[model samples]
Target: MCDYTQREYSCGHFRWIASKWCREYTLTHKRCQPNVTHFEYRADEPCGECKPKEYPPWENLIRRNKQATY
Candidate 1:
């Protein structure tokens, strides 16, 4: 089973998403700062409280970096 995490965005949004340590720590990939506010082990239910941001703030940083390299 995949690990699920409760993360908070810089915009104060929160979401329960799959935990991907490689994506978070790998330097070659775009970093997604889903500040893991909590970890839900054996999460059988979805979060119904916190609303997630429509767009992650870190996406912008990735776009900028790609443009600079081009």
Candidate 2:
């Protein structure tokens, strides 16, 4: 399983990022900083702080793609 977590920004943006690796350094040092793989305005529940904006066609595509994965 992948080690990761979801974080919510003050701007009402949600992002999925790496958490930690299980194994120690072996052959090569490949430590990676927490990286954001996805980002989007919360659609299920709107936040008043950021007052969500409508998704454009491209962003809608991203939203749909993200939905498909999970």
Candidate 3:
């Protein structure tokens, strides 16, 4: 079995990173398959997909034409 590192984000999302390769080889190209075992690690920040997006300050500006009277 291969070894991997699992990262847990604050947003409750997780990701796996391969750390070692297994002795088993693929049937097609004969390459080592790293697909088993994992070690857990905690992260203080949220994942990229879960983070809030920031918009430019100019986007919130309101423009008014002097000729237009309400």
Candidate 4:
């Protein structure tokens, strides 16, 4: 397997979007903030990231993972 220079993560919330979001997703990369490891997606396999076909982003959700620490 190949490991990119980046990573991926998410958060767990009880009342809000997880108060720990501050602890997680707080890494800095490429001068940006997506402090998580995002797997390299093949041109034909973009679905691998959100596998199990459930975490699809609807018109109401955004990919603010800026470092998902889940």
Candidate 5:
């Protein structure tokens, strides 16, 4: 069985992060094998993928310039 760690987000979402692999799988695999297991440890924070990304100041300026030209 594959082992995973549980991550809890402030947005009320849970994500499973891979921790260990069994004999049948390696790092290159995209998905866990069947009969996965989770570690008792948990993390509490906002999920990086679910959080909104902020644009840099220069990027905002470029967008405004393009809009003005239209």
Candidate 6:
């Protein structure tokens, strides 16, 4: 059954940095501090932020992926 829900995302900036051992990601930020990782990035990088957005459908997307993989 299709539930009456929607998917949305907060207007936030995100960045993924790759390392030899693991990958790092950012969801939000508090200041203008530059996020660093093992991979090289410019020093003029800005942190991410979040704004009002939908949520329910996005959760379902994650769940669906997990179920399919498992």
| TM per candidate | 0.23, 0.28, 0.46, 0.16, 0.57, 0.16
Model 2 steric clash pairs: none
Model 4 quality (TM-score): 0.16
CA lDDT for candidate 4:
0.34
Q: In candidate 6, what are the lDDT values of residues 1-70, reduced to their tens digit?
A: 1112222223334445322222222323222323343333334444444433557756866634435553
Better of 1 and 3 by TM-score: 3
lDDT of 4 by residue, 19-67 (tens): 2233323553222232333443234333334445664568357647678
In angstroms, how far off is 42's CA in candidate 4? 3.1
Report the Cα lDDT for residue 60, model 3: 60
Residue-wise lDDT of candidate 5 within 48-68, one digit each (tens)?
776788877787465344355
Overall lDDT per candidate, in order of appearance: 0.52, 0.54, 0.69, 0.34, 0.63, 0.35
1-70 per-residue lDDT for model 1 (tens digits): 2345775544455567756555445655564555554554433433444434466767767534435553
Which candidate number would show the highest TM-score if scored against the true structure?
5
How many residue pairs collide in each prediction?
A: 0, 0, 0, 13, 0, 0
How high is the lDDT of residue 31 in model 5?
A: 60
| lDDT digits (tens) for residues 1-70 of candidate 2 | 3355676765666656565553542334565454444444444654455666766667745434435553
Ranking by lDDT: 3, 5, 2, 1, 6, 4
Determine which window of 10 residues in candidate 6 has minimal summed lDDT.
1-10
Q: For model 5, what is the alpha-carbon lDDT of residue 37?
A: 62
Best by lDDT: 3
For residues 1-70, could you state the per-residue lDDT of candidate 3 as single tens digits?
5667777888889887777655563334454544647656566788879889987798669675769877
Model 5 ranges off by over 4 Å: 27-44, 63-70
